[model samples]
Each structure stands twice: as structure tokens, then as C-alpha cells.
Target: MKRGVSAVFLDRDGTINVDYGYVYEKEKLQFIDGAVQGLKLLQAAGYKLIIVTNQSGIARGFFSIEQMEEFHKNMLDKLAEEGVVISRIYYCPHLNGCECRKPQLKLFYQAQKEFDLDFAKSYVIGDKLRDLALCEKEPVKGYLINAEKKIIAKDKNIIICNNLLSAAKDIVGFKNHESY
Candidate 1:
């Protein structure tokens, strides 16, 4: 068996970038508040940063896969310039009915298979409930970014944070609290 590594499965749209709906243009790529600093903290904490996102714009005909890839490349390059390196990115381009969408374990399992992730110690940070669905099925911790203050976590293990930086701080033992 392969040795397991702890990873942080991040959601891209609203969690990292400004979700302006079906964002496929590289020029539209804008990181949310404190996203770069939060990612840097996670990286410094020795957690492999991986992006797990659901991009249904392809299926909806709003954007092509090539366009999305270009956007991702630009985002990666920007993050790299900020000293935040993403270990991998797994995206489900299918619509809601697909098995690889967020809340489904297919892409998550694929990421685990590729990296031999230690789910027990891993974490998920996203702006939506579906982004933290793995917490319902696995032992990993979940941080629901309540930047919009619209979500209320029902699960005990699912924490509520104002942004990615707060979640990263809590994960790195910089703070001890139920919510931030």
C-alpha cells in the first residue's frame, strides 16, 4: 500500500475566485479576499493543496473545455507567482445528474487514488454544502466558508468560517474555536 498524505481539497469558484457565474475567461480570474494568503498558510502547514471543483458550464454549453482549461492555467500561474502551488486539480464538467459532480465521491476517490490521501486527517474547504459532502461520508474535516453568511452547517464536524484564511488558520492550529 502507498503511504498516505494529508491534502486540502479546495473548491474553486466562490471559495477561491470571485464567482461571476460561468467564469471561463482568464481575464476574469480574480481571487477572493485573502485567498492567496490562506493558500500560503495551508502550504506552509505541509498540507498538499488540491482543487476539486464542479464545472457544469461545459455541459450547459456556456463554455468549452479548452476555455476552462485556459482559465485554470491562468489561475495556476497567478497562484504560482504568489508562491501557492496546487498539487492537483480534479473537475467534473458534467451537469447535476453526473456521478462526478460535487457531493459525489468519484472525483474525490480518483484524487485519493492518485495521491494516496489520508482522508482522516485531510480537509475540505468550500462555499457550498456540496463542496463539503465528503465529510458526510468520510472522516475528513469540513469548513463551510460562510462569506455570504447564507449557510448554516448542521453537521458537527462541518465548521463555519468567514473565509479561507480563517479555515486555514484553524486547520494549522493557530486558533481553537467552533467557528471563526
Candidate 2:
């Protein structure tokens, strides 16, 4: 039997880079503070990093798929330069009501099957409540990034953090050590 791998499912727009509304240009790519370091820590801790994003801009005609791909390529290249290796990216280029969009489980199930993921040991991290939808359906823990600390979660499986790095730190049990 193949062992299930643990993974960290991440959101791209507001969670990773600054959300400049319908961002599709490489020139506008900006990593949120501690995002790179957070990913590095997760990767180092043996979590397979995967990005699950909803690129509604494609559906809204704000950007083409090619442009989004180029932006993703540039972002991936930059992350690579920083020694962060993303295992894969699963995106739903659709508007609200798409089965594959965030808060939906289509993409999540696909990743689970492809990776033989261990839900008990995995996590989902993003800046929106929809990003933590996996927690409602699966045993995977969720980290909701709310820098303002405004959103309140009633689910015990969900943890709200100020940013991705804080979530990463909590995931790897480095909540107290802050020298990274």
C-alpha cells in the first residue's frame, strides 16, 4: 500500500501575492510579507506544497489564460529562485458557482487522488473563509489568513492567522521561535 503524503494547499491571490484585482501581469507580482519564508518552512518540514487558486479573472474577461499562465510562470520562477519548489498548481478559471472554485471540493478531491494525500496530516491555507472549506468536508486542518483579525471561526479545525508565515509557524510547531 502506498503511504498517503501530507500536503499544504495554498491560495494564490491575496494569500500569496498582493491582490491587485485581476492580477495577471508579471510586473505586478509581489510576495506578501513572510509568504516566501512561510513556504520555505513548510517545504522544509516535508509538506508537499500545492497551490489551489480560483482565477475568476479568466471568466470575467479581465485576463486571458495565457496571461495568467505567464504570471504564474513568473511567480513560480521567482519562488524557485528562492528555493521553494511547488509540487503542482490546480486552478479553476471560472466565476462563482463553478464546481471547481474555492469553497468547492472538485479541485481538492483531484489533488487528494493525485497525491494520495493524508487528510489527517494535511492543511489548507488562504485568506478567505472559502479557502478553509476543505476543513468542513475533510479532516484536513485549515489556516485562515486574516491580517486584521476580523474574521471569527467557530470550527475547531480552523485557525486564523495574521498571515501565511504565522500559519506556517503554527503548522510546524514554531509558534514561539521567530528568528526565521
lDDT of each: 0.90, 0.92
- Residue pairs clashing, model 2: none
lDDT of 1 at 167: 91
Q: In model 2, which runs have C-alpha deviations exceeding 4 angstroms?
A: none
For 1-180, candidate 1 gives per-residue lDDT tens digits of 666999999999989999999989999899988888899989988999999999999999999999999999999999999999998889999998878998898989899989889999899999999999999999999999954566678788899988998899989997643432
The residue pairs in collision within model 1 are: none
Per-prediction TM-score: 0.93, 0.96
Query: Residue 52: error of model 1 in Å?
Result: 0.7
In model 1, which runs have C-alpha deviations exceeding 4 angstroms?
A: 1-3, 147-150, 175-180
List, residue by residue over 108-133, the lDDT tens digit for candidate 2.
Answer: 89999998999899999998889889
lDDT of 1 at 79: 97
